[model samples]
Target: MMGTKLQVAVIGGGAAGLCAARHLLSRGDRFAPPVVYEVSDSVGGTWIYTDSVGTDRHGLPVHSSMYRNLRTNLPKEVMAFPGFPFGPHLPSFIHHSDVRRYLEEYAQHYGIGEHIKLFTEYPLPISSSSTRSRSRTLKEEDQKSYHPEEVAIKSFTYIIIRNRHYSDPYIPNVPGMEYFQGQVMHSHEYRTPESFTGKRVVLLGAGPSGIDIALELSQVAQEVILSHSRPPIASPLPGNVIQAPGVDRLSEASVLFQDGTERRADAFILCTGYNYSFPFLAEEVGLKVEGGVVSPLYKYVVHTRFTSLCFIGLCKAVCPFPHFNCQVLFSLAVLDGSCPLPPERELNAATAEELRARLESGFPARHFHKLDSLQWDYNNELAQLGRFEPLSPILKELYENCKAIRGRDLINYKSYNYKISSGSSREWSLLCPQ
Candidate 1:
């Protein structure tokens, strides 16, 4: 027996939300068309560049993390979603503007703009007992709760999007930090280097943002120190940049390192990363996060306790478009009753087992949500279970190869172009500068 059409609600009209709407619409009669809610006045979420950083005219915190000079680290070939190729004339590596234009074109080509409600925000779920109650809490002239007509379209509905985290950037606690007289700010507050052109800057953390910011600031800052707990960076750094051990404490005007070294800097930037947050989800949902990771998500998409509540594009360090494609299709299949899922207890056990293995393998608690090397296998499993085409093998091979090159030549890797040519079903070649 066929179930009633599901009315899916997609949150945050970014890459993931856009893909979800496209797939749900393509499913035709099986599902009611998806309604996308976007807080911003446009379809692109983080891709929409805004000069405003702290807050907008409406006092909402800015969500875009893109810097003015930022360009994609990955090639256009792999970045593009399946069946939607980037312009052939464009270079393999492109600027952020190009990506924004591409997303706009995608929305227009698929007629997704009409289905999206720009500037409309949905309230977080209340609770399982009153998930359907029509209660009015927050009032807004433009924003609103789901309408009866929309909810009545289907007996089941689901929404999927990546979690928002930039509203509150994480900062590590260090003794005497309160006495620091110099400027202290999170990387989320940093948009450009114009203000710090002649100042010495200390950046915490050595993740991608820290490395990229160090390089960016080296061009302007008098001195840039990348302080991190990890081993020294492998790539050559700019002349103005230096590496230092993790910070031990901060004195009024300087920082003391664990190695008994101290340096006074004009400013400190906490590139320590962000915390997982869902402002709209109710407290009783039990979607708790510990050590920067969300828990009890079966296959990292469906909630083990409530399978109807799913999350897509939650994994880190992946080919986002292809990954979203697999996840959305798999989730929709499950909702449509085509894919048989195990009991809730079994699903919860599976998630626990995976988390245990990852921790036992020496991965830190912070890396619980990271799917860097394991993403390919995970995507394949979703595709197999949902009976959809898995990501091309070339995608995995090229992604791994590019990561190595980036680490070795961080300064010049983006200068080269790449092309993927497939000769047979499984045979492919990645063409790049030798």
Candidate 2:
């Protein structure tokens, strides 16, 4: 009983969850096999593409925002988890199906798929008596499949929420939305660009998804107005696509641009991004999402009050799989007493100080978790704290270079091929100039 393995319940069998499970299995002496609860039948989280939108057959909202012809923006070299590289035969940037298959392969290679509890709901309210948390309602009768004893716990049960924030799409609020009602939709509902053929579409937000969707629609749409608050993208857009300032508001038949221009749009698609929703987290958890920032999370992984409660894949503008790996290791270290966390007050103060520093540096409160270039150091700190190997230096170099390439030509950036040399060379290169 003294050496009993810790029970870990991973909510969401996405890449992050799988990483958590893999590490948990790696340290069999410390951790029991993680029970990964995934709402979908598969393990690929948002990468699992579906043509269906709005709801699934079970009447649940569709979580995948993948559209047809979508490909990974990050090259497989950087996208892959450490020690597990994407196939050499595969291109640098690959199709969504390839990415899905990569995740499946990662799960299988680590025997993580066997530990996954598919279609299982998670994070029901934590029982006051025991540290064990009861799972909420399951969809249909899939609850019958999982053995409750597997998720049983005594002390704190580690909850690794590999939750995909992309599920909750966020459309910017503009005044007078009730007046001009075209086929207003979020990027989540976009499956194929064929329906927009011969239509005037005004897409909101200039993020990667917005620009990508606009480019796709240009293949069919007669006119595409890409609206955004960010500086005008210098890259050449398709003939049918044009750039405009952010939308001021909507009239009965037109949208007014911030620069005093107006356009009658047949469809308005919001690529504004999404809200981080953890519906499974009970109210007592004390975690809060305010203005797009999830708080009480020290260093973005460990919950200050609930030390065993950890989050993965929450930071944006990052190389996801490796980031998840670092976070998972750090979480396990905290739980296993390898990386002892600070006291509650110190933890909260650290979180507050980090936020305050970022805010003072001109980062918007809503974009506090947008790590971008800061992810390299964040990952390194996690590795240093958790006693795990940090990511290769070349990965960050490649990542930054790719961002520049994407900015130079978003339309053709995916055409490039890259290769990271094997072992401690810590070097990478562009394979071919496309």
Candidate 3:
């Protein structure tokens, strides 16, 4: 048993951060009240959308990538935190505003707001040339305002780098971008489609955001070319929307595709994806994200060498809220000594081996943290190891059912509602209009 309550510093106030704070608060005997760092006044993290992009008033890079008119592709049934369900009357598929409201209510219910430090920015410690003095100074500043009791960060203190992963948008280097002479933007800057009316737009990825933006733009854009290297989408597309091969290069005013075809593009949007960024981390800490893979992490949550530094929600294609719950619980268990962690060397080897197997199976280096069908198994494993109740099987059933449904009917998938049968053996009911 720990002699003193451990102080946890939670970075970011999104769902993952809030989940960490809530769970930490619930364990009052074992934990000091958490200190949550958030850039905005709100606690919804990336779910909080703003008209402004690029930078905030404080000049911090905007953390949210949410564009206007985004609805939850995953139903609320699968999206809610394990124990906290959304309102019964709400549509299974909800708007971003509704999702934000849910997060706000959750924060209030758990009294997490009282512990949150708002409008705070954590500079990447490495940004300063001198690492030791910089880390000490930053720690001293943070120790001043910890409410209920101001406490010094001792050896047992844990830092949760919960800065959700959608901020650092990735746009691959395409040759001739300088001479293209067209307005090029990442989907992060996209707010609404009205500005591109009558313009021929080339969207340089076919990820969910890329496809959704194409649908949204089809209503306004004169022509939409969805450029991708993935297999062709089977869903019926709008008349103006056309699928094209990946871009080989760009000319003065057009994009050259790998198939040797060329398309005139008035504008270009890169929906490529994001990088795993932790600017606040110093080099001595030994975390690396190369080829879109974050390493030296055991179970992708705990730092192998420095177990005191934990990360939440570094994953992709997950039931984000539930995943956060499992991750937080397991991390706490490890930190509190209820569940012991392996040695640093063993942890590193195990971590590397799993990733190597994934790569050898033909998955790309960028998909190191992807947990699609694997998410259910991953979540259950954490619960088992952490001695917590496993997530209900019905959640997986609903999630996969919705995925198949969405794949076949992208346009009308969100229209369908789902209801979870009450109790442990959670049979689900799919609701469709008469």
lDDT of 3 by residue, 1-434 (tens): 45588877777889999999999999989998887867565789899898889876444568888989999889999999978999998999999999999999999999999988775554235221222212121222343332222223223267777856798888799988778877799998899988999999999999889988998999999999999999988878888999999999987889999999999999999999988888788778888889888988999999888888788999889899999999999999998899898788999999889988999999998898998999998999999899999888888899999999878777788899997776656577898855
lDDT of 3 at 409: 76
Which ranges in model 3 have alpha carbons more than 4 Å from their true place?
A: 1-3, 123-156
What digit string (tens of lDDT, one per residue) describes model 2 on residues 1-434?
A: 53588888888887898899999899888888777878666789888888889877555568899998999899988999989988899999899999899899999999997888776666565432225665543445543343223343334466777878998998677887778778888998899988889999999999889998998899899999999989889898898899999899998778899999999988888888999987777677777899989988989988888887888889999999988989998998998999998799999999899999999999999999899999999999999999988888888999999999899888889989997667656667786554
Shift of residue 396 alpha carbon in model 3, Å = 0.6
**Selected candidate, larger TM-score, 1 vs 3:** 3
Instruction: Tell me the tens digit of each residue's lDDT in model 1 across 326-424.
Output: 899899888888998999899989988888899999988778778987999999999999999988888888788789988888877777777656555
Q: Which candidate is the best by lDDT?
A: 2
CA lDDT of every candidate: 0.78, 0.84, 0.84
**All models, RMSD in angstroms:** 3.6, 2.9, 4.5
Write the number of the candidate with greater TM-score, choosing between 2 and 3: 2
Q: Give the best candidate by TM-score.
A: 2
